[model samples]
Target chain A: MLVIEDLHVKVGDREVLKGLNLEIKSGETFILFGPNGSGKTSLLMTLMGFSGYKVVKGKIIFKGKDITNLPVYERARMGIGMSFQRPPTIHGLKTRDLVQMCAKYAQNKEIDVLNLAKKVNFLDFLDRDINSGFSGGEIKRSELLQLMAQQPDLLLFDEPESGVDLENMALIGKIVKNLLRGNGESPRPDVPMKELKKIRQVSGLIITHTGYILDYVNADRGQVLMNGQLCCEGRPRDILEHISKFGYKECVRCLNK
Target chain B: MSEQIKIDRFKLEGMEVEQDLQQFVSKYKEELEMAGIVVNELERSGTYLHLNQNPLQCKSHQSGLEILDIKDALSKYDGLPDYYWKAVDKNKDEYTKLAASKVHGGYFIRVSKNVKIKDPVQSCLFIKDENVGQSVHNIVVVEEGAEVHIITGCATSHKVKSALHLGISEFFLKKGAKLTFTMVHNWGEQVEVRPRTVGILEQDAVFQSNYILLKPVKIVQSFPVVYLNGSGAVARFNSILVATPGSYINSGNKIVLNAPNTRGEIISRAITTGGEIIAPGVIEANNVPAKGHLECKGLILNDGVIHAIPELKGTRSGVELSHEAAVGKIAQEEIEYLMARGLDEDEATSTIVRGFMNVDIMGLPLKLKQAIDKIIAETEKDMF
Candidate 1:
């Protein structure tokens, strides 16, 4: 549901992404593997239309509309959502209030915020200040809770497994898979699996340094990003195996080839 | 810099008083409601209404609570031998001197020992005559092992402008007593306000003070101080201030911890759209094992100024004191974070400002809290 062509982004006098091209269709999940400072977050930020990540030469098409220069709120309203890695803490703004705000544009106007928060185990933090003194895993769950309320057509995740423990990782992985599959923990018991998968259409673009998320999500395709360029493409499991065996240094050979 | 108010421009006396409570409530209902006074409806333990230079109405519905005019209380108790002008000095400033020279009218509320008053005592100091100068001296005393709450509202009539209000308030809390005092100010655009206040707490006494100012005024300057004199006593101060165009507010709070095991905290939030605000706070700890903290924050929306000054002092080696102060505009990161949730810039900004001015921490009554929320919402509309 999103397309980028020859995207070149600059962040404060330094070019971070160069000649990047990618496309994801409806009902598809794309996994991006990258090293440090390899422009993974830059791509997600540019896609979401954040300020300070200037698009020097590029065009973005989302759902058949050019949104390269749209404001952040307009893009969000047009069904593009992002989960930040380190979100800012807003004092006196309760988590419940934010979730309600996110649900403002949803098709389902009446959303049960407390019930949605229960799925992510964030009921205790509903009345607390958003993202204040939250642990790493708690931040992830809070983000997921907000995304559930948003129900956007496209989701951009930035390292969902960065600071999660083993137990929390399993819970987060299952939720992420459900979000991408468009079922959200509720599947019809009468419909066949194939039929159910055909009725739901949601797209995801996930960035990960570690392939620990492969065990949960059915990622359709995977690609490697190194030095501001996409170098390799293959099955997510196969790409993980190749990188684990030889490290990201072997990606340069693929780039040269 | 702020505009100067000439004391000679206002009249000190000769204003008529409306002796009927129903007539007074019907005349200035909106203004009184804005100042958190619900006349003839709310279940208040006592009610006191003071017009310029006159005590129009004073009565107490609940037993064990006495509400009288300050002048009557003075003569009744032989100048209130233990309470009148005990905590606050009469010669501290020009406003205090004016209030001392001619005590127009104020409330004198006292709760009997070991009696817990359920409903709050409501009082209103109103000015309805043009160019009238009103001076008042208020005193509240909570006896030993007693509990009470007082809501004091000060306002000027809609048609009355160019008035000066000078107020002097003193509070005394005995051993193991609890007192919660809330004051709301809703003055006219040309009115100038000056209030001097001080409070003293005994052993195991708890005192909480909440002050709110949402309406526009020419100038407002006050710095209230409280002292913890006995061990295990606690004190807290919370203030929310907003200044519109042509308004100038200079206010703060100070707490002095004198006994061991005493604690104090001061927190203030201010916003200036096109006016000026100077917020200063201080806390001093003199005994060992005492602790105090002060926090002052301000936000400037348009072409205005906000100055925050926080100070802390410790006299002994084991005393702990700290302070934090910040004055600036809203951070862009906070705005963008909210924008990413699908709200436009204006909506997101107003939301953030609403949170910044949240009064939930004040623990006010539900009706008063709702009234203040409505006022904040109306004020936000003018900011944009």
Candidate 2:
């Protein structure tokens, strides 16, 4: 669903991502594990088309369309969605209004906004400004609520486990699991597993620092991004275990071979 | 009135608003209709009056509320109390002099002692004659233990290009009385408005004032003062102003705390697109055990310039006075944050502007708050 080839990105004068190559097919969930300052957020932001992250050399192909140079909103329209690490508080724009805006391009325009808000336990805050005075977990859940409303083809999450507590993490994990499946509704349990997977299949590139999200999201593959390059790929759990045991330096040492 | 006369008299002290008198009146009538200004007798429980440089019509249903023209009020009471008369005497300006010399239209409101007025008294004041100055001398007296709310709207039509509006308002609150005053102004691009307002609160009395201006005007300069003279008296001033292109707006308030334990707060929010706005505020604590706070926020939408100067003075060591003032463009991050939520750049900016102007003022009556909110929303929609 998304292709990033030979991507070289620069934030200001410093190069953050150099020659990064990545791709995610439809109905696939990819987990990116990285240490601090390892260019995990840069890739997500570049894909989301934030103006500050400039692409020097590379092509971002989304659904076979070149969107490397598109503005942020246009990228959003092209079905590319991102959950910011620190979303700024907008004073006048109500949360309900924002969710409605996200649903503008959805095939089902008449999405039940309050019900979506209720799933994230944000119904009371629907009338408030976006991210205004929200705690870290509240902000994350609010972002997730917008994504559910958007129902985008590709979802980019920046560090879903960081700063989230146990309770919030469980809720976020469940939501992320449903999001990957492309539906947030409770499974009838009577439905067959294959049919559910087909209904829930969505492409997602998620950044996890604690790897706590692995317990919730059934990620198909895992990749490690270190120093602006992809150095390893394997099962998400195995890659996470390898990093936990040896640290990212061991990956660099193995790459030297 | 066919000929335009550049009369040297009543030229206003600082700004100018004058065109042809007949044409101004005609244009004003059209604007009055649009503003829903009823000129005929308004007989209802709550008083609703219209003023066109004079008290054109007045209807009072409640026996406790006495609405009268300035002349009738003066003659009926034999004369106003020396305290309120002195309040008007304090403003020594050319416009005040013009208003005193030839008072055209103004209201006298008196709430009887211990009477609680539930329904608000509404008034509409408009200016029609360019050559004919529209000067009003208004007085509001709430007796001891009384409660009342007053809503006054001042406006001018499109064709009434130029005209001068000078308003001299004085309010008095007796012991244990409460008064809430709300004023809305919509003036033409060439209109010059100079309003002199003052309020005196007695012991344990409360006074709240709300002012909103959204339309364009050539010039508007106002600095109303309130004196918390009695112990435990409270005063609050809330204002929202939008100065459109080519307009010069200077608005502020000054509150003096005289009695121990008196409290005051002044909050002003201003938005300037391409106009020049100067928001100045002053709060002086003259006695120990008094507290006052001043906050001014200005939003410059385009190339407009805004100057926010807040001055706080404390006389006694036990008094506490503080102020905060800021002037800047809307944060780009805020705009982009909204845009990321699927709004275009313009929609995002407008939403932020609407939010910036949404400064919550406590104790607003639900009806008045809803009206103000609707007006603010409409203004935001029209602005962008």
Candidate 3:
């Protein structure tokens, strides 16, 4: 569903991602494990087409169309959605309004907003400003709530379980699982079950630091990104176990040989 | 036999142009409608097209809101009400004197004791004749333990170039009473407006004032004051203004805490595309155990200038007062954040601008709040 070929990225005169290549098939969930200062975020941002993340030399193909030069909003409309690791607090923009905007892009635009908010335990925060004064767990849930509302064909999650606590992690895990499986709740009762299932089962590229999300979604494969390079393609669990026992340096060392 | 008197003694230091009244009305019907005023009630002079046209067009009787023409109210009581000219002096400025000497048309609203008026009393002061000043004096009295909301819109037609509007508003809130007043203005590019307003809050009374000026005008100067005279009284002032190119706006507000345990807050948000804006405010804490906060923020959308001068004065030792002021462009990060959510660049910029203008209109009725939101949305469409 998504392809990245020799994607080179720069941030303020410094090349962050140097000739990185990755691909994920339709309905597949791919995991990316990288240490701090790696080019994981750079790849996600470049894919989303944020300004200043200059694509030095690369092309991102999604759904058989090249989108390396599209604006952020055009990319979003083309069924590409992302969850920021640290979403900024927006003053005077209600969380409910943002969620409604997301719903405008979803295939199932008639989702129950109140119920969706309740799924992330954010029923009372619907009227509050977006991410303003929110706890780390609340921020993650808010991002996930928007992503679920959008229901994009290709989802990009940056550090989904980074700052979330254990209690919220369970709920986040359950919701993320539902989102991937195409079973998100909808207010419309007229949609057929088959179509709903087809609409919900979306492909995603997830970035993780500690592999805590591995307990939730089934990953088809995982890759380690180090020093602006992708190496060591293997089972997500096995790669996570290796990195937990031995640091990223050991993984890089073993992969190079 | 009574004689019809025409007062023209007050004049500003500027020239006024001539315009056709009928053409002016036809050109500004949309603006008058946007302010939620009935088209039939609009008139060139102090006369209603329909005698039975209610000022509160939407369910006024059910909410127990009494709306009366200022002339009729004055005639019925044999004179102006006691609260008239009580908050704001009649001889404060040339504009106030102009309003008092020849008050063409205004509204008198009174909420009885312990009654809550759900619907806002809507009034519109529209100018259809050029070179003619529309001077009005309004008075509102909310009795003890009562609550009410008042919305007033003022505008002039684009055809009516170089007109003047002098408005004087006085409000009196008795003990334990609350009043929320919202005023919206949309003037032509060659009009000048000077409004003089003041409010007095009794013990435990609450007062809120919201002002929005979205359209361009030749010049506008206003400084509304509030006096927290009784213990535990509270006052809040919120304003949102946009200055188009070649327009000049000087808006300020003042609040005085005369009793202990009083609270006051002043917030002003201004956006200048190519005009000049001077936003100045002051808060005075005269008694012990008083608290006040002031915030002034301005956004320069183009090569315009904005001066935000907020002053805080505390005369007593037990009083706390602070102020924060800033003038700059809209944050690029906010724009990008919204753009990532599927809004285009223009949509994103306009969304952030709209958010900046929604400056915490607290304690407004739901209907009034919705109306204000609609006005903001419509005005922003013309702005960007």
Best by TM-score: 1
Per-residue accuracy of model 3 over B1-384 as CA lDDT, tens digit each: 111122353232232333344553465667665554444542211111111111222224534456677677788877765767878988886667766777665677778899986655666777655655666667888899998767677876556776777778888999999998888887878787888999999999999998888888878889999999999999999998888888899998999999999999999999898888999999999997999999999999867889999999999898999999999987766776766778788888887787787745555545445656777776677565
Range of the 10 consecutive residues with the lowest summed lDDT in candidate 2 chain A: A193-202
* lDDT per residue as tens, model 1, A142-221: 99888888888898999999899999999899888888877373577998777876765789999987888888898999
* Better structure of 2 and 3 per DockQ: 2
Give each prediction's root-mean-square deviation over alpha carbons. 1.6, 4.7, 6.3
The candidate that wins on lDDT is 1
Error of 3 at A31 (Å): 1.9
Query: Considering summed lDDT, which 10 consecutive residues are worst modelled in model 1 chain B?
Result: B1-10
lDDT of 1 by residue, B12-53 (tens): 877767688788889888888888887774768888888877
- Per-residue CA lDDT of candidate 2, range B249-350, in tens? 888899989999999999998999888888889999898799999999888876787889899999889999988888998887777766665667887787
The 10-residue segment of model 2 chain B with minimum total lDDT is B1-10
| Model 2 lDDT tens row, A59-159 | 99998998888777777776777788899887657888889888886556788998998898889999888898998898999999998888877889998
Better of 1 and 2 by TM-score: 1
Residue A154 displacement (Å), model 2: 1.8
lDDT of 3 at B87: 83
Between prediction 1 and prediction 3, which has the larger DockQ? 1
TM-score of 3: 0.85
